[model samples]
Target: MDNDISKLKIERQPLLATPRKSRHLGRWIGIGIAVLVVTGIGFSMANRPTSVQLTSVTQAYPSQAITVLNATGYVVAQRKASIASKATGRLEWLGVREGSTVKAGELIARLENADLKANVAQAAANIDVARARLQEARAELQDASRAHDRALDLKQQNFISNAELDQVKARLDRAKATVAGAQSGIGAAAAGTEAAKVAVANTEIRAPFDGVILTKNANVGDVVAPFSSSAEAKAAVVTMADLSTLEVEADVAESSIGKVKVGMPCEIQLDALPDVRLKGVVASQVPSVDRSKATVMFKIRFVEKSDRVLPEMSAKVAFLERELTSHERTPKMAVNPAALAGDGKEATLWQIVDGKLKRVPVQRGEKLGDLQTISGPVKIGDKVISKPTDHLKEGGAAVVAEK
Candidate 1:
């Protein structure tokens, strides 16, 4: 019976069975695991927000759009003077030093005036002596005139000799001449006194205009002189500048000169005071051009001068095509230039709305410094992404980078 069961195809019921379907099932399970891993990775990637940096749309002006060029120059005072004494003498006193403000005709320094004062005293004494001599001459002339009249009367009455009358007349003439000589001496002495007073007045160095002292070139006991070349002589007692006359001398390139005009609006920046922006206008343009630097000089007068503005300080200026109003100085709408995505009259900026990046279109205008003028749905306070990723699309969430 065992031999017959073995012969029957069963041979014996095996403890384990090897099926072809098992190999295929194992392969199918591996494929399913791989698919789950790929799906999970994709889901994580799709949910991640794009990292971005953001800037604001700001208020700009009309002239900011018309700015044609920018150039660097220096702050210069159109009315600056070196205060010095016209008369050469040792400096006796200095009233103003560096940073001292003075008014027009204010005394800034004084020179040694001992000799001038002595000369004035001498002239006064001489005039007194001359005046005393004139009084004596007048008395003598009066006496002489009386004697001449008496002699003339006696001669007429034939009680005196003719020779006596002639002698008295001659005495009267000599007395008159003496009186005239004394009067002339007094006039000459008075003129000497006047000249001495003027000399003393010249010893004082005065401010020609209202200004601030920039330097104190001379000190007490220093010899001050005009056109002084001697090492011991100080030519300028103090250097002063009119703060009100402060202007910027900008060097505009020849190629860009055509865009600048007289009275064109400008923005001025000083290296020393970088945070404060100054408003100015193109006051004048130099007739000549600098060949060595290929630049034309443009003089810009500040609309409002600050006390911090100094002479010969480094500066930068932006020359616009037209003048701007006081309200225009403050921008109406502006944006960073980096936010612009395309090149044309219209600029494209990606804006974040409800945490999603959205493409915004704005009409581009002239630039003010680094800020660009724009007009669109975006207003002054709206924030826009500065730089966005290429893969970032409309309605995609963007995360502001902490960095």
Candidate 2:
């Protein structure tokens, strides 16, 4: 029985030893997998790109000489005027409002001048009364002259005293003086009547020029006074501006004022109209400079009429240093800015030669738009890596892929 117990203990020991050896084999397998994963990660990190992938474009670009002048200003009207009443009265009617186009001598508004009308009637009546008085004085003077003639004849025949003839002559002269005074009074009345008529006519306001009304200061039923010191009196009935005489007023720095002169070509861009570029010429350069702003104001007139342009519109002016040549306006060959590296001094690019990266040196020219002009030892059909990795050295094997 003791020998049988020893044999069972030995069998249990072998079974326990077999489980320990299997555990050790499983640990070695886990360690090998972990090492392979680390090696793969290190290789991927070493082959990663140094910079981000960028798109490269090869196309034509401009290489012309361009001078950029930064300037800002506003559009203004050259011919602007304010419409106001010429006589004091209540505004009865307004024929035009703001933004209304009017021609010269066109009625803009009318005033109710009751007092002026009455004065005109009174002057007309006085003129008639003065005419009647002059007629009566003339008749009396004729009658006196006739009587003096009879008296003179009687004196010549010795039938009357010398005193009687002298009295008749004196009466004739006095009647003639009374008629002269009545005639002078008639002339004065006629002048007063004409003046009253003129005052009544002045009550009606008219446009002095053909232009668009910008502002309407006085409305219907508002009292308008001519040449008043009060705030309301100083106000204009309507403000009008000529759209045809629109001009751009640009504030150019004092340093650049010397380059600008009258008759120089200018390109104007309105904030309201973005797609359109209007041509203009420097009309005049103001002699004086604005000391506070340290700038000189220049006036530019549009060469062509534009219906879209208005007074006081915001605009940007570009004063071209030189006109573009025919070839410069045309397109030229260019490549992506990212394709060429360095401060444009030494351009470096990666070219694919037989499925391997080949570093190539290139010469670059002026940048045009988003692409730059490149010229050197590179062909058009050759593929270039837009974003190259540090591991992608010359003669290095590479696999081409599309982004």
Candidate 3:
């Protein structure tokens, strides 16, 4: 019976919804999918980190080493002299020019000393004549003494009159007086000759100490004088300085003067030779302050002097509590100065943590090379925003730029 019913049937069921309703349902489904797609895109954007360039904080001992102060100065010579002649005369010879080395008592130059030499010669001849006169007077005095003795014997023996004996004694007295005068003349002549010899010696100019000539102010045939009022007159023969006594005279800020002390270890750098780093020590601090500049002068002596170094070259001094080791001189535990913000009294840094920038306060210390010392929430290996911008905010996600 079931087989016969299946053969008789076959009517189609009515559509569940009208064609418009089906269209409406399709439209709503598409709207929901579009909304879901946009929501996913927003979520993805929120999870993304910000794009930023980063710099790493260094870890090194040199940055942490104590740097007491920094000052600008120039290289100077401690023992410098402007050599000049003591008397007015034409320069006949010049032994040293610029960069010539000289020793103490070395003859550097000579003057026109012909007149002085003549004076010396004349004085010597006078001394000889005076001595001859003195000798002749002494011979006469001896003769007079013998004559007076004979006269006394004659008077005692009553062989001669008293008047004649008195006359002989008077003659002896006059001869003795002449001998004394001649002796005095010899002494005066000797003194005059010595004075003339000294005058001749003064015509030769000599070096006061061992040093190298820095400048040749006067040349051969130049007129040298003790005090030069005329432009042509040369006051100094040469400007010389003891190279061994070279020192750096730095001008330290008066406010920071307390940080500097005599014998402090220091590092010296010259502008002419930028690659060299010279070791030095604080030699002294000037007692007075420069009121106009508001600075104090300090001197630094080189530990190992270099032949390349010269006086008057520009230099910089870094005074330290102790000498810096080879490694400590390198950058360590430091960050780029640009990474620091809110400068002056207090400084802040934007240190990255978990891919986000975090504001942290730090104590700014002396500059190490181009990097600065920062004692704050940051540590070695920590990434910091280099050249932080206004868009970079605290706790904001930051993405480090790829090199």
Model 1 C-alpha lDDT per residue in residues 37-93, reported as the tens digit of each score: 999999989978888988887765555466678889998889999877889999999
Evaluate all candidate structures by whole-model CA lDDT and list the values in order: 0.87, 0.79, 0.85
| Candidates ranked, most accurate by TM-score first | 1, 2, 3
lDDT of 3 by residue, 9-100 (tens): 88899877668988899999999999999999998886677777877887544623476777889999999999887788899998888889
Q: Identify the runs in model 1 with alpha carbons over 4 angstroms from their true place.
A: 1-63, 325-328, 331-403
lDDT of 2 at 225: 82
**Which residue pairs of candidate 2 clash?**
59-334, 60-332, 60-333, 61-332
Candidate numbers, best lDDT first, in rank order: 1, 3, 2
Model 2, position 125: C-alpha lDDT score:
98
lDDT of 3: 0.85
Best by lDDT: 1
In model 2, the runs with Cα more than 4 Å from the true position are: 1-21, 24-68, 231-234, 321-403
**Error at 246, model 2, angstroms:** 1.6
| lDDT: the better of candidates 2 and 3 | 3
**Predicted structure 2: clash tally:** 4
